[model samples]
Target chain A: MEGDAAGIMDKSINVLIVDDYRTMLRIIRNLLKQLEFENVEEATDGREALAKLRAGNFGLVISDWNMQPMTGLDLLKEVRADPRLKATPFIMVTAESKTENVIAAKQAGVSNYIVKPFNAETLREKIEKVLAHA
Target chain B: MPDGLRGRGASAAAAPPPPPSAEAIEAAVRAVLGSLEGDLTAKEAALLAELEALGRTVRRVKAEIAALGVEDITASHIPSATDELDAVVEHTAAATNEILDCCETLERLEPQLGGEGQAALRGAITRIYEACSFQDITGQRIAKVVAALKAIEARVAAVVGTVARVAPAADAGGAAASPAEAAAGARPPPTEGQALAQGPQLPGAGVSQDEIDRLLASFD
Candidate 1:
């Protein structure tokens, strides 16, 4: 629950995947699983994600751009606005790859960004980049 | 209404959402654009945000359909797709602008999103990942989605074929219309279809080899 990526870390990393789409969530989990990051969890959206975050210690967050009640952006801002969760690196998985969204996410303090329909390497590269920068 | 009839399509209830067309797609986009156009009042924004979410779902569905090589179905559903798409793009523009607005707001208040507020936000970001990254287990990004769409296309084509087939039998006994004509008649009007065919032409609409090549450029 509290480690960085294995190839990245000496041990494993705890990652949380948040998206309303079950398939997308599965896809991301499978991607991270490929990277050997075994300690991962899933949440349907931000509200549940908040619950899990409160319940456990997580290392990295890879979240969708859109979701109900709270979006990944909102969650990002919320995390930034909160004391307990700030400073944790967050990456966004977005279908909307427009320049504006990326700049906004960056300003909001996202660790990095990846467009949706992304593969293992794009994901791994982004995660590694974020961790290294952090 | 018959006893056996009830079980005939009983399996349909468990089917994944039927690509979200008609009323569903309409309602989604309307909410989407409404949310985006600054048309939503304070309370309406919340509801519209939800609609924008649905628009994303619908778009993803269209993407799936496109991947399946079922161009006809996409063409047939073009009205709903275009409407939903227009709404989504517009709404997303709005939301992205909103995020921009908020960042400006934050900057005016504090240059940095500091304190515990920042901590929780960062934590939430990390945890959300553990929940959603299954889309890329090993590497293949488009493979699973492509596979799922192929299966659905097979199912939908089968259903459409069955529907088309049923009409021929109906026409066989003294009916005059050919199956194509019957198929044509069963559909709603042609206005939307016509507009779609004649619509903005999507730059490179079809999933041609070039487009596939562009998408696969990374892996290749």
Candidate 2:
């Protein structure tokens, strides 16, 4: 299992991170870099994120829940509804820790959820768990 | 006559009076009517005086409301508060990024150091990264405050609108657009999901990570 996780993590998978806050986007990107996932891309809001998701072949998506124009939940629903993007591993990284938010994300077919103020280890764990399933 | 007998005799001797004359009845009725008319006139005068006093009170209240400068609060002070909060978010974000940049630089230099030094550098970098998350949390909290300020500003502007309608001349200067107009123009229609997108919760306010994990597990 460890070997399998390692093999999955070692792959050069394209990752897309969505956040309205530029600093948050940079922070997530840096965290992904720390985990050696260098092929990371970003979009500021869900609409732009959807566009990027359609244009690119990203293996994973880490998104913030609250954003203008379109929210992360809306993006997840759109992704799930799209046949091509339905199977993409999605992880929600948000400040919204409400139970309803978690339930909504799960129902929308999210692979995992990470509450905000989380460290790199938590991010790593979530990514590994999500990709392992993938 | 003896006292009782004489009184009885005197009553018997008195001639029977004719029924009250029509003229006398008319005079008596007129006097009662006059008294009632006088009372009504006094009451009417008192009521008029009371109404005048009430009118004066209402005018005074209107003046007081105008003096409060509700327009300045909504137009100037509330916007300024939001702008300051926005600046706080911006400055913190910039500082956090700078810190992250420094950490990245240090990480890059770690490879050249001895094994112990490299480990120490990695630990410090990780801590810095974690600490820098304060920027995101604080930014979300401040954004929530800004949203609240806007809501308050809207409410104040609505009051101002009502006052302006009640006393149109109160805003004689016409220096700025009516507060109601400004609020209507400035306020964005709330998005559907805004209520659910509550920013960072205060400590002990929202669900914990462990609880979230357990909930997900239940879904499985």
Candidate number with greatest TM-score: 2
Cα error of candidate 2 at position B47, Å: 10
**Where in model 2 is the C-alpha error above 4 Å?**
A1-4, B1-57, B164-192
Expressed as tens digits, the lDDT of each residue in A1-134 for candidate 1 is 12344245522667888976665665576557656688999998777887788777888888876665667777787778878888777988765444445556666777877765455666777687677655
Clashing residue pairs found in predicted model 2:
none
How would you encode candidate 1's per-residue C-alpha lDDT over B43-116 as one tens digit per residue? 77776777677767766665565466554653465445445545654554455445434533443444267898
Best by DockQ: 2
CA lDDT of B33 in candidate 1? 75
Candidate 2, after superposition: displacement of residue B135 in Å?
1.0
At residue A7, candidate 2 shows an lDDT of 71
Predict model 2's lDDT versus the native.
0.80
Give lDDT: candidate 1, residue B87. 63
Q: How does candidate 1 score on lDDT?
A: 0.57
How far residue A123's Cα lies from its native spot in candidate 2, in Å, is 0.5
